[model samples]
Target: MVQINFAQKQVNAKIVYYGPGMSGKTTNLEVIHQRAPEPNRGDLTSISTDGDRTLFFDFMPLDLGTVAGMRTCFQVYTVPGQVYYNSTRKLVLQGVDGVIFVADSSPDMMEENLESLRNLQENLSEYGRSSEEIPLVIQYNKRDIPGALPIEVLEEKLNQRGAPAFEAIANTGQGVFPTLKALAAAVLDSLHKSSGSSVPASAPAAQPVAAPQAATAQPSAPAPAAAPAPQRQTISMSQTGFHKAPSLPLQGAAAPSEAQAPDKGARPPQNAATTPGPQALGGLQLKGGSEGDGGGLRMAQPATPPAPEQPPTQPSLSMAVPPQPPAAAPAPTQAPPATATATAKPQTPPANRPATPGSMMRPDGGSPPPRRAPASKSFPSKVQEAHATPKGGKPKSAALTVLIVVASIGLGAALGSFVLQIL
Candidate 1:
């Protein structure tokens, strides 16, 4: 287990010393601890069973000088080497970052050395680690023995990954530091590669090296121009089948719009419907004023009155015309017996007059169409008569109407008499 303590600027790793029983594993740790500077090493701890085997393991903390500004510490452990203590070995091997296999150099102990090596492999496999990747060093300990096996022979037999090997007499500390240093360096190298860090984690400046690249980045391109405002629909008298004028020209030969100019002084009529909206035509959006009102325009019918019997003969005349333009005091244009009567003898309707079709307009050079008093009776007056009690209860309205009629007749008669006198 290799842990980088970012908070303390320390790097801690576990180093396990593994070997067969009586193979001098503990001796190597003791030598390292004793030789390590007092300021750099922690207390050594050892626990053993009655059979002279390590009951648990030996633990010591060996601290080293700052490497790349990080305090380096190694937790050294030596597992019990007897075959019967295999469980303790596996437990001790957990999270081991590096392993030092101290093999006995005695020829008689070769089988025991091989057995311990196999034990190490099994323990590492149990933790899902491969000996090939872990930082490992081999020490042929008891090298001072006279009958020690040759280094070449030991290498051929027990060097699992061609790991670095050293001959060490653990009690005297011969080659001990070299083996330890090599394994420590290897473990640190692995840590650096895995972290993708050029310096140790203790160095805070590693992250700031990327600042220049960020500063060199170009400013974002100007945001795209705002989308153009959507096209707006416009209303026109021609399109709504309506006009603002009091009356169309008597010449009806020309369209009302072409005949009469707009009245600048006139305000929009209170009764004017809101501008017609463009309805979806098969999901197609049409341009404003593209459609004429005549497509659906018709005279608004009185709610209570029955629809009039349409003249079967004059189908063209019977079809209703669009609503008339509103006027403050409109002068009704009477249909002459010339244009309309020539086409059909259709009976005129009573009540609110229907729209006058333009076809009823007289030709040019013709006198203005005559106005009729009876045709001028307002529909509301008829409604008044129907609803009012007739026995003088509503006499004021009737008398007012009669007075207006008499005055109009008298004026006409006087004008005739005056014309006679002039003649």
Candidate 2:
């Protein structure tokens, strides 16, 4: 697992070194701890038996510089290699981001190497991780010992996945840094792929510090040459094979020839070879000529000057009639005058007309047609009146008033009887 702390701007990952007992897993870590600078490495903690065999695990934290704005730290651990300690090995493997399988190259230890490798695969499977998916590397240790198996034999037995393999003699610290560097690069690549960030293959890989003279006392086959510094490069893996991603140019920098090549899917630019020149007017070619020459093109001569202006000519005036308004249509034919009685009689309401309920008669000597109460107001007002009325026909307020009057009358009668009795 890669733990990212945004507030701290830190990224921490775990890499485990796993192998059988006496495979120099501990030695590999010791070499790294000794070579790393004081600022870049942390105290190495180990739990081992009296014989110096690792009991639980060995932990060393290494600071690989910043990547994508986060300071990257790797907690490197070495699991106990004894067969009986499989449980402890599995515990150390938990949350591992990468694995370094250190195998003994001695001819006699071949079986032990095979067993350890199988154990690694099984444990990784238990965690729902696979050697194929995780960043993995193989280091064939004990290369300095006589009668050790050749690189080819080790590959045949242990390199089933074809992961990058390194030859190292951990006792002398030979091949130590290269192995670490390659594994770190692969781990970073895996992280970038998983995170969907652009993998920076061009970022320089860290170089290992030289080990103390005592650490390199023995010489393995002249330590394999350190891999050359990386160029502007990117690495990609596919089902077919590992392919190099085209190097992308830095911002504002010219791209390399390969990157500048047009993509097969893109359309070519129109007029890519030439820029548009100034336009010509009136069929004139303006190249290499003075501005006044009009590019040496022929022009129509100027026309003769116009005649001088003439004075105004007066016109004779005559009387002119103004337009008349449109004639009006003949007045509409008048209807015959209504006969007028000598005395006009006042209009009166018909005796058969019936007055509407709930309407008052008008006082114009004639009863206007009775008006009906508005239907909308009539229903709501009737509901309000019913709610306001008590069981009696009058409203509650009227009933209260009548009660007050009755009380007053009873009191007055009582007072009058008292007065009469007094008299």
Candidate 3:
């Protein structure tokens, strides 16, 4: 049986080892407990099963790390193979999700293996579970013994259920882990399939609720819920992974625009490449073409989106780079961004060089020198003007008054000379 604890987010399952006495059932659990990592396994426990002993332990296998969103864990229990412990075997097998039937490979013990096999099927039937229904695996242990029975002979009699079988020498820990891993995988696989088959059976019960809701005020709200009316966390299992979902409290679908994101996968390239001008760099490569194509591609992506902000700048850029026409088209488009860059750098005007060739030029090819001459003086002249002025505005006003005073003195000297000559 499988128990899911929602609070702990853990799935618990049980697997029992069944076989004849001295068939290596106890050795299997001992080998796994000793070899398994300390944190991965719990304490090895012993139970007194009427004069004989039984062993069991808990383990977390990383190969089956998580199912759905919950951790998967299992307890391995071994039953005494002695025929007298029939009641104890039934008690152990009560809720078993899976079984690993370990058979002794010695030629002398073949009869004991067959008896244990019959006993296992009889005990399973008492609990109302079919031997064919539950997950089962067969392991032929003691393969390293001299003149051991052949694995083919063991499988011919023991594997009537068509379960996966393995040969092991459990005392030396040769095949212990593989046997346990195979059994854990089978258990989870059965749990998933059983859960899936039951989902549709409960769906019809939800269908009749729609008729009563339709007679109420909110018919449309409950209409869609009738579809797959019994909702649960779907369990999905494969060689790649296992997912066992549970009754989640609440969940929401993505917005319609976000849900349609994958449909737009063919969108960005169409929009980005439209302005790059027909693969100016062909897939066929030359030494120079690779760099030019890569650079032009890198430059065009950023330039294209912002081109909408200032549509006028591209023509000036195209006109400015006429000398390099054979170069790819995207390089010229990149220059449109230099309008702000050109204005900022004009303070440190170049003597004859254009301040960024693309931004300073016009489409008509006129005023090449006129625009370049004045834009170069970006900063130094402002300090020279502040040093020349005495309170800046007062210096201009004082010069006009000094010119008027000098004119009055010249007129008075001319009148004095005329009076002296008359006397």
Best by lDDT: 2
Error at 366, model 3, angstroms: 93
Task: For residues 1-423, write the lDDT of model 1, one tens digit per residue.
Answer: 699998899999999899888777766675565456567776555554322245578777888868668998999988888898798789998999988888887788899999999888888999999876777767777555555688767766876355655665444334455566556655655675545447453322111011123211121111122110111111112221122212211233344322211211011111112111111000111011101111111111112222223222231112233467655213223222223211111112221222222212222212111110011111111222333453454688879999999999999999999999999
Q: Write the per-residue lDDT of candidate 3 for residues 190-244, one digit (tens) a residue.
A: 5555555654432222111111221111111112213211211111111102111
In terms of lDDT, model 3 sits at 0.46
In angstroms, how far off is 418's CA in candidate 3?
99
Candidate 2 residue-wise lDDT, 1-423, digit = tens: 788899999999898898888887876786576456666776565555423456678787899777669998999999989998899899999999888888887788899999999999999999998777877767877654556687767777887665656665454344555566666766665666544357444532311111112211121111223332322111111110111112111222121222111111011111211111111011111111112221111111112221112111111112233444444312211111121101111111122223222111111111111111000000011222323433444677788999999999999999999999999
Q: Pick the candidate with the highest TM-score.
A: 2
Candidate 1 lDDT at 412 equals 100
**Candidate 2 residue pairs in backbone clash:** none
Q: Alpha carbon lDDT of residue 219, candidate 1? A: 15
Off-target runs (Cα >4 Å) in candidate 2 are: 65-68, 194-197, 201-423
Model 1 misplaced stretches (Cα beyond 4 Å):
50-52, 194-423
| Superior by TM-score: candidate 2 or candidate 3 | 2
RMSD of 2: 45.6
Clashing residue pairs in candidate 3 are 68-243, 68-244, 347-378, 349-376
